[model samples]
Target: MLLIVVLCAFVVFLLVVGVASFLRSRRDDSDERIRSRLGALAASDADVETVEYLVRRQMSEVPWFNTMLQQMRWAANLSRLVSMAKAPGTPGLYLLLSLTLGLLTGYAVFLLSKMLIAAAVLAGIVGYIPIWWLKRRCTKRMDRFQEQLPEALDLLARALKAGHTFGGGMRMVADEFDEPIGSEFGKTIDEINYGMDSDRALDNLLNRVDCPDLKFFVVSVNIQRETGGNLAEIVGNIARLVRERFKLHGKIKVLSAEGRISALILTLLPFAVAGVLFLLNREYMSLLWTTELGRSMAIGAACSMTLGIVIIRRMIKIKV
Candidate 1:
């Protein structure tokens, strides 16, 4: 059947993608990669004529397409998001992948429903998956960076109390800590040493890292530079505050477990019932998708279910 052919092709595509991802993860050249990116940060200064010639970021490998993407702000944002996520592949490459998958899925849906509008809408929605995946990756990386922040701060505080200079303290953190915090601080130090203003370097780090707690650290350091304070004590206090917040975050997660479970059950209840009915009465359940009116009702039910899930998730998600 056409459905089988389409599904088989999709499965092949998924297999290829999964294998590629596994291989990339196993590449494990992160140290050299970190050094190269840190080196780039120094070279990318506005003062460096060499930086102009360096291919810092390309939205696409293709000349015309890259030029077109350069003119599009959203595409540039996507390229930046990829960098922040430390993800491989250009925006153009991901777009191509999404388009291919969307076309495959849309064709299959068309084959089943013979509905142009529905197929097109579904294709558009599905095409966003790759971008959504990149954003998800970025968020997870940022969360990891945040989790590492408190310890990095404590390390820096210890370095300062041991009589190291501010830059030296940062260098110690860079050498001792792991990524993304290590690479981030190392990059900031590189920028500052390479003639960028300290403020500018820290601001660039802030842009690269999306942790709210880092903002407190940055603001504290800046204030210390202006008004003068025991920087070690200040940083140590921030570290303690961050750890306390983590404890509170754990408590919040425990408290919200019940709402999460309820939401999950509510979301799954319809699917469980549908499965039971299908097992008990295949012909009746089959009519749902096998007829026009049944298809319309199925679409309505799907939309309503999606809306309900979104509302429930929003209700349960708590911010730290």
Candidate 2:
């Protein structure tokens, strides 16, 4: 009788614990959903459905932690580009893999360095270096993509004027022009024919490209759909505006090029001198790697070099 009573008590305890756990999990999931929805609302001025769609699309591409990392990367990248901005890691899984490689490289560099503390400090900076460079490369690519957009729109307009359907014109661009702009438009047309709504298809294109200029292009098209207009004329105007902006930007870049080159030389000179000195007179330079005073000097040199780089970059960046 006592054994039967004890068994019953144990079973009841287990059942109670399981039910509590289940309730807690349910609450946590609900809280997460609410938080995500709030975040979506904050990030975009999109309608609830649109925001939800974007959130789901992003979530599907990356798990939670990775999504957070990519967002952080995007913000950092956007801070640097004064002309056109973009979010990171939307194009390819290669970006995520590059991040992992960067992390490993940082770890290896840390392991190899003699000073554990400095190594760890440098690890984070080094890890982000690859990501920063990748962001720069992507930024340039996106700029080219933006530059091509207005021209492509004009082409579509011309094709339309000649009585070709929108999809047929897009196919022409895809066949005639280079990636990634032509390819992106081609994908949009293909998706539309595959039963996707034009709005949703364009939205997907916007996400894939993730450029502010491209966003403007997509918004323009969607608005034009609801209220009829001479699309070719609108596109031509956009093209003219873009060309003028690019001309101004090109002039600014040319003016700043000499200063940038000078900055590069100044920044690299000290490091080059140090390398030569270390190679030519190891005994004299050994103090730097071996002594605390030398270490302090090394740190100072690094900090000053970093400050100079930042200042030079700021000076050269003339926002249009």
- Against the true structure, whose TM-score is highest? 1
Q: How far is candidate 1 from the true structure (C-alpha RMSD, Å)?
A: 4.6
Model 1 agreement with the true structure over 102-156: per-residue lDDT tens digits: 7777777888767766788788889789889999999999988988888999999
Off by over 4 Å in 2: 1-113
Error of 2 at 273 (Å): 1.2
> Model 2 over residues 1-320: C-alpha lDDT tens digits?
69546745654554454344334333334544454444335334446576555544231133553456346656334333311233332322333333444445545555555665566556567546645676677678788887787777678778878888767877887777787787677767766765567788788777667566566567777888899887666666766776677788899999999999999899889979989998999889888767899888888888888898999999998987
Clashing pairs in 1: none
Q: Which pairs clash in the backbone of model 2?
A: none
Off by over 4 Å in 1: 1-56, 275-282
Question: Largest lDDT belongs to which candidate?
Answer: 1
TM-score for all models, in order of appearance: 0.82, 0.65
